[model samples]
Target chain A: MHQKRRKRADERRAEILAAAESVFAERGYRAGSLAAIAEAVGISKQTLLHHFPTKEHLLVAVLERRDLHNLGIVADMGLTIEAMARLVDLNLDWRGLVHSYTVLSAESVAEDHPAHEFFTTRYDRSRHALADSLRAQHGDRLPGGLTPDQAAPLIIAVNDGLQLQWLLNSRDVAIGELFRAFLATVVKGEPPAST
Target chain B: MHQKRRKRADERRAEILAAAESVFAERGYRAGSLAAIAEAVGISKQTLLHHFPTKEHLLVAVLERRDLHNLGIVADMGLTIEAMARLVDLNLDWRGLVHSYTVLSAESVAEDHPAHEFFTTRYDRSRHALADSLRAQHGDRLPGGLTPDQAAPLIIAVNDGLQLQWLLNSRDVAIGELFRAFLATVVKGEPPAST
Candidate 1:
């Protein structure tokens, strides 16, 4: 019975987090309210508070949930240009999640924002990981006269900047195709001078 | 004197807009309040409202003020990579404006955000202008087998992505230098295959 209750509690937490993501996506991190999230979860604010003691905690959890999903994808398929492009394809199914990500990342730029550390660490780890993967896949010498280190940030930048553009008009921007094209330019083997 | 009063009013409007930029920078577009902006301007909310009717109108004015500054720069110096790198250097002095711009641009991705249309129009105009400038500067072929039209958005993406990263840790990321490096890769002339 104790194990059964623990499992039920875990399921309930997932339900609340899903609701929180939708609320945060629509209303934005700062503008979104815990009360609304509770309402969405069909629970009292106190019950919601039991799971997430503070709004900041809940915000962190929401970001962690996204990180977990991304980590699983990268881990299962290794970090390839194709994997990153596939991430963009996955992003289309959940525009709200993408919206929250863009908003929170920008919001998190402020030193005092709750999610500030979350994004700072995220960028650092992601860039480092991508750089490692690029080096591993292509050996030390990469294409376009750029090292894996230099190319990593540019690829990450395009990945993010494309989302902002895609959000505005998905019809105009083919996120996956454009990303594939971007990859093509840089992955054409080392430049003539480098060679 | 009516002329003197109008001049004072104009000065006050400028002060309020500057204050708004600072507040919005620190607190973000949606979370920052009109009351806070009025406080920063050393005036009552009523007086603030008298100048700009609503918070949305003030947002428009703030964005317009930024555009005018950017326009002056681009116009004074053509849309060369040097000019853009200079713009990045200029951003260092006004971290607040850069912060607000990043946050608002991300926020504006949401369709109903007050700044949504403003950003949408800005990207379209900026991209078009950039593409035209590139074509005029370089004939049909661009460096990486891309048309000027294709390169335009990529450059803009780098510009924006760099800002987001720079905001997190300005010391580590030399925004201007990084952008200049990106320009070098893209301006190296058409790929070997393209020829």
Candidate 2:
């Protein structure tokens, strides 16, 4: 019975996270209210609070849920085109997660935004992680003559920017195909001489 | 006397656009109310309505104001690295404009958002314009061997994506430098063998 209760609690927590993600994705972090999230989950605000004490706590959980999926994709990831391709496919498969992440991260640009610290830290870590991976193999320059430091964030930017475009208009843009072609230019091609 | 009246009217319009862009940047389109924008502009909601008529009208004006600046940069743009570098520099100078555009454009991913059609049509045209420019220079395949159609939106994605990263954390990322480096790989370097 203790095990059963624990399992039920975990399931309830997940339901709240899903509701929170949808609300945040559509209304953004600041505008996405706890009340609206409770209503979406069909729970009272008190019960929702009982599950996650603060909105920031809930936001972190939502971000972590997505990151957990991404961890699976990028765990021990190489700078290979194939590894990055899987990450692209993962994003394509999870539109809700991508939408929430893109909206929250972009909105977090404002200095005082709640997610600002979260995003700044995350981008820093991810850029370093990608840079470390690139450095391990390429030393100073990738095929395009950019240092791992310069190339790492730009690669992340391409991924972030592509999602916004796809989110804005999925009709004309193809995220996966475009990402693959871009990786082709960056990861291979003859190393250019210019800065 | 008539000329003075006309000049003040234009100034008021510009003021409203600036205030509206700030509000929209912070709160997003759906959540950004006309009253808040009026409050920022030190006017009444009625006066704001008188100027824009409706929220959609205001959004179009804000987007167009940004587009006008962009048009000056890309009016006779070629697929050269130099022409694109100027645009990267242009965005770096316009932080407020870039923030608002990134926020609004990302939020407009929802089909029912006010700026949906506006962004869709604009991206469609921009993608085509970039593709046309690239095609003119490369015939069918770019220096990186991807067709203009395939490469065009990715260039846009990189620009859009880079802005969000810079917006999130200006400490580490350099938009202009990264963009020029990426452009170097795409516009020059040897024609790559792969897609």
Displacement of the residue A74 alpha carbon in candidate 2, Å: 2.0
RMSD of each: 3.9, 4.0
Q: DockQ: which candidate is best?
A: 2
Report the CAPRI category for model 2: acceptable
The complex in candidate 2 yields a DockQ of 0.47
lDDT of 1 by residue, B41-76 (tens): 899999999999999999999989888898799889
Which has the greatest TM-score?
Answer: 1
The DockQ values of the predictions, listed in order, are 0.46, 0.47
Query: Model 2 chain B — which ten-residue stretch has the worst lDDT?
Result: B186-195
True contacts kept of each: 0.41, 0.60
Looking at model 2, residue B120 earns an lDDT score of 84
Q: What DockQ does model 1 achieve?
A: 0.46
RMSD to the native, candidate 1?
A: 3.9
The pairs that clash in candidate 1 are none
